[model samples]
Target: MTGDEGPSYTVDDALVALGFGKFQILVLVYAGVGWVSEAMEMMLLSFVGPAVQALWNLSPHEESFITSAVFAGMLIGAYSWGVVSDRHGRRKGFLITATVTSIAGFLSAFAPNYILLIALRSVVGIGLGGGPVLSSWFLEFVPAPNRGTWMVIFSAFWTLGTIFEASLAWIVMPNLGWRWLLALSSLPTSFLLLFYKLTPESPRYLCLKGKTADAIEVLEKIARVNGRELPSGNLVSDHEIELQQIDNPSEDARLLSPRTNEIKHPLGMDSNLGGISSLSVLLSPKLARSTVLLWAVFFGNAFSYYGLVLLTTELNGHSKCVSHKLQTEKSQDVSYKSVFIASFAEIPGLLLSAVAVDKLGRKLSMSTMFFICCIFLLPLVFHLSEGLTTGLLFLARICITATFTIVYIYAPEMYPTSVRTTGVGIASSVGRIGGMICPLVAVGLVHGCHQTAAVLLFEIIVLLSGICVMFLPIETMGQELRDSVQV
Candidate 1:
């Protein structure tokens, strides 16, 4: 079996044969670091806003800009990096994102003025934008049966990051200040670059792009690391698989025929299909409905998730049971404590989703979480005791965090390898739009005496998000990763 010949086994077949082991752990650790880095940077926005406001005596609008700038850059980064990973390679995208995030974030600590600080943080956001690619990259290596649980488990690192940021803010911001916090927070991301050499491009991506030999090389490496061997056959190219699909469109085609003269793209189009971008492929008739619904889910999830995060401080501020000394103390201390405490809710949320994601499936797990999250959030619209309000916020955080992780898993699984990152990146970018607007509502309106209206808006959005999840055409739980739209 020469490299040019159609392999007797598929990528999935080889992965199943290898099973999950040490190599998969390595991939998870590497990918998880990216998650941690991105989370810290994002969580930084919540902590830094107030400190900067106190230092510069900036208006509320300016403090809000700090958060919006990052999301704006994220919107741009998510779209661009997705396309980059789809076209160039996932490994390259990972390297670039880590490099950009680490350097830009570190420089943010030394900004001479507020304008420079925002500009630097925006650049950091650009690097942080490729976060969805990590999900796609990690998922491709995992077997279908284990994909949901593993992905949710991987998302736990993100929660760890948020907690770490809160802790770091609590320690540093109260003493060393925001500059020190920024410096310390940005430091961890730089380590990802040092560890980048440990990761390889997605073998599934290599196969779809017709790099069969390179794909095989990666698979073989994985097998070696896992103390196993590839399935006892030549690995199949996506082109060969597509030919079998064409020959018998309704069933799994396993014929190992030689390559044909007519080359084909996975979207059931000719290889020479012109002027079609990955975005266009996603919006094609075959995938358009799923794409739109998934986008809506993404938007709602972001609006509610980030809105609740920003609202934590507001909720804490309204509590009447605070001691007189605490009221007179630095607001940053109280804010960080509330954020730190609320973030713990994500642990149980992640644990629950990890279980439900596999048992109940992705669509059901996500919709259920969104609805439950809405239930917890609704009570906050009315005045309540501080302890009751705190309890409600914690419960709400749990559900929203779970939904956030599940949505990331579901979006990538829905797309073909050719545009997996692109689909995820675009969806994530739409979510950032929600993240951008959330400050205006979560912080702005809440502070402007429209707290009731703001919480009600979040409730409605969360409820609608659940409906969109139900409308999704396919459930990805245990579904084999699709290499092309044709499959």
Candidate 2:
């Protein structure tokens, strides 16, 4: 009995000796910082869109191209980073991404010509390509039960960053100009790197790499943070560890192995898959239907969401006139203040999403939100009055934001851990293609028939997305992650 007790104490003591409580908080903080970096990258472009147009004398089409270029880079980056993270380690990929993105963001601000701006914006996308990898890394560390809630919280930071950018643009763009605003956005990335430096690598990543000792060390740190101690009997043996070690092999030798070869050329598919190999995996007969449906859902939603946002300044000229008239009695800050308030509306939606996602179930919540969004859009298209259109836009924004949040959470969970980030990255990249196309489409429609036509196109996209959402397999909620996929 004494010996048994001793072993238990040894395990517990080892964990206690590690001091994990403080460490886990630090990890969460690091994750939060990463979220902020992503947020800043996303929001900065939206806030500065008007300013860039003014400075560069850009037509709406050129502005769309600049924005689309960033998304294109992101699409490529997401796939690249996913593979890198799976091959290397999450922390390494994250650090490199932060460094490059921060540098690119600052450089983009200083871009002197349209070509240079496009190139730099693409670089910024490449830097942001690390987002899905970081998201996966954080998800793997947290307990399954708490995963949804934590992910929601992480996403909320995105909204917070949006608000921050909107506020900054309102204040700084007028005084310091848009370039300074772009430069200022890079500041958070530096803090993110510092936070990453202090945080431990993912325990799951360590386990995957056959580093059992290191994995245990990280777990002990987590246990300590949670104010719990590990039991000696519960301790895992090296033999019990499932991960395989590379055994210090040469790179060529490593690539020649069956496992590595399979990863390189999966499912006896094409030999020259190029960067599209990961995407090809999603197109398999088993996954093709889901893949196509998801693509449609994402495309439709992104087209509508981004189209609406991009056309915000154009919608309901009468309403803008009214707003302008009302603001005649208000300060110069009135428009800025209204933008700030609309930005904040995303906060509550995010918070509610974080709290309700797991409980409400992904498919149901998402579909319901989409349906509500469709209802809101109907009013916008038919009512056509300035005040009614503006009110409907607000309602639609909240609904669409919540639905998109569900898609982000649900999309990644649909794939296996092996290709989780890859799948999500490709999905997101596809959505960026839509993001690129939507604005152009809006511009064409608006040019032909004014804002009403643009609004109608958006409504069609939303309705299509909603219908696609209904067809998706509603099987992810409450299922164990490993067990989530049907195949």
Candidate 3:
């Protein structure tokens, strides 16, 4: 819009008129690159785990610590980057996180010993933790109607990165070893820095910063990218910009106030309540129930997803035995190939969920997928024949992968903007705890007792989480991001 006199247009018309073909595609591509970088950093640890164990002669407990440490860093990084993004802008925050991640990943490649490796992994976690926050920045720029699809499309890059990592492991591990894989993972981060030059700062963020002209310029760039002409309407005004910048009073007061009743609910006279009022807010009556529900959802999803993925490496090892058996009949490395193909199942799941999320609604889509996952996993627990189990596991993985995507989208949508990143970060941090624990749990399940029992427990958790999800405020579908929860 040119000035204050231009006619108002809906977000959809503005997006379409701007040229949805090339410009939006380019923006998505740019965002996708950063996503791939973040995903690579997040997942490379899984592929490298066995190699690290072998090279370092690490005990099972020590090996678990190494992986968990990175997630610990992620917990720190996610909140830190959110604060930074709020203070600075999304562009600078993205650039800074990308740079830090690249450095940390490269440093991890050269870690001299197991202790150093674990430390570096934690550092890498801090750098990579900014990914979700940056994704939020991207969402802020787009209109709400198109936001779900865009976020879904953006999420596909995560699977693409995982696919890339698996492919690289398939090709490079046999020849170059895992160190090379670790070193190579940092390469995508370099490319993202280059792509970022063409990407503009979030227009909404600019508006919040009182930069009306700059915000307008960013919006024009978005229109140009989408291939639409600028409307001859009044630019967003300073007053409107100021109003947009106003932080939600409820959230702000909660963060800043000294009142104990507002901050937390006392458990009982006998309970050991002390100086941790902020942490206690999580247990308050108004927020406590939702918090526990979200935690269960996150914990269950993480435990199930990571447990299965960690098992993939074991399956890959089993594939070698299958390959050996098939080798008598043929000559291909069929086991490795099977593992690679199975890892790729995530791609289609991500793409399909990306396209279907808004149309289906987050809760329905997520719960349906979780139910499908439970169905798929049941055969595995019965100890079906290897071939059948393998196929079922692949199918189960795809469904769970889609469910994971929905959770990421739903988690942020459920919270208000003031506590949006904080809430998601806390959930993510808790999920990381589950991730850290799942591997050890898997070890016990597969080695100590029965794999079926371990997997069954995971399925039960997923089912419970899905049930909990149904009780959530289901009215979030198609709703605008709010400044406060409407209890």
Predicted structure with the largest TM-score when compared to the true one: 1
Tens-digit lDDT track for model 3 on 304-337?
Answer: 7777766654443443333243432242244345
Q: All candidates' lDDT scores?
A: 0.83, 0.65, 0.66
lDDT of 1 by residue, 249-275 (tens): 442233343222233445722332222
Point out the higher-scoring one by TM-score: 2 or 3: 2
Across 401-467, the per-residue lDDT of candidate 2 in tens digits comes to 7877778778766765545666777777777778778767655455345555666777777877888
For every candidate, C-alpha RMSD to the true structure in Å? 3.8, 7.9, 7.7
lDDT of 1: 0.83
Total clashes for model 3:
11
Against the true structure, what is each candidate's TM-score? 0.92, 0.80, 0.80
- How high is the lDDT of residue 198 in model 2? 64
Q: For model 2, which pairs clash?
A: 20-225, 21-225
Q: Which stretches of candidate 3 lie over 4 Å from their true place?
A: 1-21, 230-292, 315-338, 382-385, 415-419, 482-487
In candidate 1, stretches whose alpha carbon ends up further than 4 angstroms from where it belongs are 1-7, 248-265, 268-276, 318-330
For model 3 the TM-score comes to: 0.80
